[model samples]
Target: MPKMKTKSSAKKRFKITATGKIKAAAAGKRHGMIKRSNKFLRDARGTMVLSEPDAKIVKKFLPNGL
Candidate 1:
């Protein structure tokens, strides 16, 4: 059988933590930061775990993650 391929985009946007959780960058901080509040920008400065349902789907794209 052929080797399963990893989704390039998912690989770029998601990371598998040491504990096996899907860690992703928070959204809304990608552009136009000057207009956003300081609090909002500060809050988006970290990674977030995907919900159980969403994680299930994401794991398919990252079998090694699960």
Candidate 2:
């Protein structure tokens, strides 16, 4: 059988933590930050865990991760 490949896009955008949770960067902070409020910008500056349903799908792409 052929080796299963990891999704490169997923690998770049998400990370599996030591506890098996999908960690990802919050959106809306990539560009045009000058128009957003300080609070909004600050809020989008960290990682967020994927929701259960979403996590299930993410897990498929990152089988060895979580």
Candidate 3:
């Protein structure tokens, strides 16, 4: 059978962790930082693991481990 093609967008935006969870950049940090609170900025500093339900959907896009 032919190899399945992984979603290009997904590969760029999401990463599979060593334990198999999806890691993605935190949202809401693109602009308007002035209106955002210090806590929000601090919490959004790094990438976060996708929830179980969300991870399940992302898994389909990454059929082959990246």
| Top candidate (lDDT) | 3
Name the runs in model 3 displaced over 4 angstroms: none
lDDT of each: 0.86, 0.84, 0.92
- Which pairs, if any, clash in model 2? none
**TM-scores, all models, native as reference:** 0.82, 0.81, 0.91
Model 1: lDDT of residue 53? 84
Candidate with more favorable, higher TM-score: 1 or 3: 3
Q: For residues 1-66, write the lDDT of model 3, one tens digit per residue.
A: 988899999999999998999999999999999999999999999899999999999999997653
Candidate number of the best TM-score: 3
Tens digits of lDDT, candidate 2, 3-35: 788998888888888888889899888789999
Give the CA lDDT, 0 to 100, for residue 62 in model 3.
96
lDDT of 3: 0.92
Task: Show pairs that collide, candidate 3.
Answer: none
Looking at candidate 1, the ten consecutive residues that score lowest on lDDT are: 57-66
